[model samples]
Target chain A: MKRNLRIMVIDDENIVGKRLKPALEKEGDIVETFTDARNALERFSEQQFDIVVSDIRMDDIDGLEVLEQVLARSEKTKVIIITGYATVEVAQEALVKGAFDFIAKPFKPNDLRTIIEKAAKELGR
Target chain B: MNITSGEAPIQTDDPQFSHHGLGEEYVEDIALKSRPIISIRFRLFLAFLVIFAFSMIVALWSIYALSEIQVKIRFLEAAGNYLTEIQQARRFEKNFLLYGTNLEDSLEHLRTAESILQKNKDTIEKILGRNSIQGMSLQLNNYHKVLEKVGEAGDTEERNRYEPELREYGGQLVSDATNFVVKEREAVEDALSLSRRVPFYFLGILMVLIIVITSFLVKNILSTLNRFLEYTNRIGEGDFSPILPKRKYRDEFSQLGLAFNHMIRELDKRHKILIESHKLRAVGTLVAGVAHELNNPLNNTMLTAGLLEEDFERLPDEEKLDMVQDIIKETERSKVIVRNLLDFARASDYKIIAMDLENLLEGSIRLVHNRVKLAKIELQMKLTPDLPPVHGDEQALQQVFINLILNAVDALPPRGKITVTDSKSSQAGFIEIKVSDNGPGIPEHILPRIFDPFFTTKVKEKGTGLGLSVSQGFVRRLGGNITVESRVGGGTTFTVLLPTTEVPSSVSAAPSP
Candidate 1:
């Protein structure tokens, strides 16, 4: 029952991706890091991911567009939104766009793991 | 001018706040409407007027005197000419005898008389010219005609007729000259009298004017100075009273007074606003402190009740009612905390009363005793015997003492010691209550602002930042003051001073009670 889950880590800050990837992988999900949203789009065409943990505020293309692209590719993929600048409206929009949950930056690894497990359970349904 | 927020008051509304580098706000209000320059300018004008009047009088006197002297000289010259004319007439009579019945002798006599007449005419012309009189030349021509007729009389009959005519003309001339001299003398005398009296009159008038002007100037200056002195006294006494007295003169002093009054009024307004805002901030801090104090006990009651309910579920049925009673007791405790908070926060009309300061201190200690025991802090109380009563609100004074004691207990480490001592102060004529604690002392940078609202030294969630600020407010309301002495790693001591009075009232209860 172990599924190969494609998890995309989209972060413009190099340190966020570098630090978060290993920790997220420790939760037993495959993680791919992409600094550029455009390159991430090209990669998305070749492979499909189970969850996208992307930073919402990024240069050029934002996480909302990525979420839109991932949903168009496959409707069942669960998106997990993360950002340092969290506001009520943004959280509402993420839920409306079919994101599993929204997590603010500076969160502990345990909080992220909890959200990932919940999202995985919901996806199984 | 003072503004306050109902909750979480952070700033005071004061236009002249100490943000511009001035240490504390010292406002001086001076009205610009009253000034002395106006009176001074008016006095100067009066002095100038008096001097101008005196100069005019002197000028008039000089002109009158010079004219009178010229008149006297003219009158004397007229008298002298008249006497000379009479002498010449007598000489003509002698010449007439010498040249009797000879045409040449008569001609010589007439020619000599003609020469004398010419001299008289020249003298009259000279006098007339000086006086600017016209038409006197006609009289000279008539005299010359009479002289020619006398010279032409060669026979005895002609001589007799012409001699009588010449003598009659001479007599008329002498009489007219004498009449003119008499009139001129009278005119000269009148002019001299007027001239002699003019200096006296002029000097008298000048003296009067000088006195009036000098007095007016001094009066104006003195009045203005008096107003300034009164205003300065008012300012010294913190009154900011009016700086100008009413005056009628429209001058520069009036303008200066207006400006000064405006400045003073502005300063007064600013000062009043600052004091009012300070009071509002103090009240806000008081309410916030009470609210914060109640919140901690309320939280404890909730936690204690929850623990009791959980323990009840595990206990036997026989002890279930007892557990409910404990819950009820905690609920009552919570209610008491809320009531104390409300009473402390309630705005009451301030009324003065005799306060037993030692009893108030004991009451405050009793209120905080439970918390001190819960915190496991040692408490000590040392009150000097025969401490006098003060004048203030019992509840407000108790609240201040409670706040300070609670703050001391909060600052202490587990099992730390707190000492509160009270003694009569001889120098201050009051009682001094010192609350000292063996806790970590406050930092140097934060010591000055300990009484400022929203300033806290304790770690987050342990302190609400309004205790000392509210305590300071309550002490100030009672006409008392609180000061702190502290150093890092050493204990802190807060000394509160309350003025003592011999007014007995309901607050002078036994300390143990």
Candidate 2:
């Protein structure tokens, strides 16, 4: 029996979190969305997520820091970094820092969901 | 706004008048560039001062030297007169002794000699300072007294006795007179030789002084002039670095240099403003293009989102997801366009690094490949193997090539061919990248203005008309140039000439075993 996947979405834009919450929830995953990176990082520490999708540019804690923190807490957790201002250098840095994948902004929600589904399979769900 | 009757006072608010003002300013700018800031008068003054001083020194020296020679000649003439008087007295004494002529002729000759001797006494005194020639003067008086005694003798015995005495006296007198003449002759010769030698010595000294002074003046003028030349050369090459005059002396050259430095500062300020205004204009044009470009993707996304919403219940989950993906993809497309616009408008600091042309060309081709493919364009790349690295900013140069390629793609018809060729330029130390396309060629009249900003042949939506202009700007900053050649029906070729970095031959030749 496959259990529900745990996903965390962090973006500074309120619409991004609002849109992704319902979209990911429709896929039968327990998705938690945060518009503030600090609040999201607090939520991340309180609970383990199967897949952590984060925006790379944010006030306080960025996606790379979130990735490092998540990986430090749970090595199996997949951290995916998204950015509006993505360059080859930023993408490579995010991946080198233990991100499961790096995707530029305005990406399809399905693109993220596909990565989350892969993370779920890795979790043996 | 309402139009009044024709009889109403004629409105004087013509836009052409404002444009005329702008034309005047532009003409003024041209005049400023053409006219020399340093006045010719200042330079001429410097040159005239040097020449005038040189001529003045030469004139004064010659005058003094000539006058010295004249004074020596006068002295020589006085000595010659004294020598002539001595010769005349001796000749008469010889006539009286040898021919035994009448006493009257003898006495007359004696009297004439006495007066001539007295007349020349002052000249002798002038030569020998009155005391040095007293012995010569006393000898003349003794010869005169002897000749007078010979004339007064009464009988033959008296005459005979006095004659022998007179012969002895005459002999002594002649010998003394000969010595006086020789001494005077030597003095005159000494004066003549000295007068001759002094002028040459003075002239040699004067020449040396003149040469030293003239060279000093010339060196000062030349060094200042050279500095001005170097400064102007730098300005000509578009370097606006301030010139610090080598000397702070308040000379005309220094003042001119100061004025030049001030002008350069002004020019640099004006140049900065011109660049800023140009950037603003480019940004304005880019904003228009960006807004238009963004409209299409935004509209597509909005329509797709609305459809997804309406069909949410009836459509299959896969179809719903596809629609959502379409919206996301459209959004992303708009984002990419905006990013490119911002990158084009952003004023980035220039960085020059050695870059391989092969990789740059491939990257640029890849960027435009999808559009090129969709347009059914045939793309041919003939990049020479191991083309030398050029020094430039990679991203900027990449933008340049991508812009050129896209422009070529835009100009092409269906199934057109774009040939990108790279080779070492015939101009040494440079490499050439040529992008040639076979399409409906640019019009002959329009070709010259192709690289001008905001000048476009395409419909407004197709281009912002900044691509070629921006590319030219980038190429120029990289110490290169972009030029286009087109014939009305014969397609267009854009040639980019870039300076190559001097890579060591050994590095390119072979690797060590």
Candidate 3:
């Protein structure tokens, strides 16, 4: 049997991280949630994750910076960007900047689950 | 996805708006209409006619006086010739009496004097009266008879008797003639001198009249001009009071006042429309942020409820209650976001009240929070605590700060910095707030025109260029001012100085007597 996936979620909206924790855990994965992107990034620096999900906009730092730092640490880890009022330009820029995929806000857990599944298959796990 | 419309609609409040120029409009209209028309041209004509009529009277009087003097001169000349003739007869009488010359010569001279008197008798009568002329004629007749008797005398004794009578008559008649001529000459001289002085007095009176008329006309025109100047300044300050007639008679200036009132009404109407459109534009900009902000809570509620539904059968009752509570909290958050925006978007009359600047700034910060986030710009606030309250309209001042923030956001690149700081101003009785941005500064050449209406550096579709202009207008109306400083490479800062409200100045703040 394959090892369980290590996943991380970062959103300023605390509920986004709270709800996602249990939902991803149900799918036989280890999920760590953070309301602060800086804290999540600090934790990422100490540990390794198979995937990192972050909101595009936040108070202190943005998701794109988080994406850049994560990719710099380990290029193999996949990054999924979450955006509110997502425009075409932002989505295209996220893809060009090496984000695995971009998702608009108010998406169901299953929708994120599908994108994660595709990333997981690419990892061959 | 469609907005959650199932919940009871939240918009129950009225849209606050009013026609600013419509107050007391009918009263002003009636005041302008209740006047008679009299053009300035007619007034000038009337003034000229008065002067013309006065000059004609003076001219006629002067002509009559001169003609009378001419008649007196002619009479004096005739009377002088009659006097000369009488003196010649007297001299010839002496030659006849002393040198024993022929008495015919004296008689001839006396007869000539009599003929001269006869020729000028009617004129002399008109001048000296008919009674005086008859007296002079009687003396002349007696002198002539005495001279003729001497010519007819047969011996020396008869001639000697006539000689004494001739001498008495001759001396008396000549004296009377000389006295009449001298008196008439003096009278003619007095008339001539009077006629010369009459023209000088008329000129002096004419000068005084011209001065009076000129000052009357000039004062009317110039004072009206000065008043119109004041009206233009009033309009510039956004006062749209119509001009009313101030004079008894309506003249060209009254028509001009009416024209000014018409222009004021039109300008006021246009200004109201511009303000309305500017508000709508501001509302549009705010709505986008509101819509984006609304999604967060909606998403939270959706996720919480959706998961709760899917796990309803498996989840514990405590967990279900927690999910329901989360859903409630998120819905409530959405309501607050919408309400704040709605309050700003609604129009209201100018209501100046003592307001807390710090609290107002916080509200404005919240309105532009999402825009600031989306642009990836860092916004900081350093408000002075317990600052003196300022008199201002809440909605208007809110719009002003939002415009400043949005403009800064537009100018800044991602990761740029914006700091909003407030402090006591250098000028007393004012508080200064500065919105500074670390964006590529505006070029110096176009900086002066940034607040001009319809002057824009932004693209045509993206901007109507009224944001700064309208913001400045609002601030100025509140007894405040907005200023800007920028460099080519250095960042830009907009400083707003607002007047602090003094205690007990407001009508409501004052204690009743």
Stretches of candidate 3 off by over 4 Å are A1-3, A42-48, A72-76, B1-26, B29-39, B84-138, B141-156, B182-216, B244-249, B347-361, B375-394, B400-513
lDDT of 1 by residue, B1-513 (tens): 121111111225543443422222222212232223444555687689769977886898688678757956764674555546554653565366356534344345435534544555544455445332233223434544765666665765776676666666556655655655676667667778777888788778888888887887778777776776776554433343444436544455555555555555555555445445544544464454444344433333343344444454565776556545654764675576566545544566544677666677776775666567556688899888777777776666776677777788778877899999998765566788899998998888889878765578777555556556656765665667899999998989999888887554454553333
lDDT to native, each model = 0.63, 0.67, 0.81
Q: Give a tens-digit lDDT track for model 2, residues B424-493.
A: 9999989999999998788889887887655788787666565676577667766789999998779989
lDDT value, candidate 2, whole model: 0.67
What is model 2's interface RMSD?
11.7
TM-score (chain A) of candidate 2? Answer: 0.92
Which candidate has the highest TM-score of all?
3
lDDT of 3 by residue, B69-93 (tens): 8988887887787888788777777
Q: In angstroms, give how far residue B299 of model 2 lies from its true place.
A: 3.2
DockQ in order: 0.01, 0.02, 0.53
Q: What is every candidate's alpha-carbon RMSD to the true fold? A: 18.2, 21.0, 7.6
Sort the predicted structures by lDDT, highest score first: 3, 2, 1
Candidate number with the higher DockQ (2 or 3): 3
Off by over 4 Å in 1: A1-125, B1-44, B86-272, B283-292, B313-349, B359-385, B392-513
Give the C-alpha miss distance for residue B1 in model 3, angstroms: 32
**Stretch of 10 with least lDDT, candidate 3 chain A:** A1-10
TM-score of each: 0.41, 0.47, 0.76
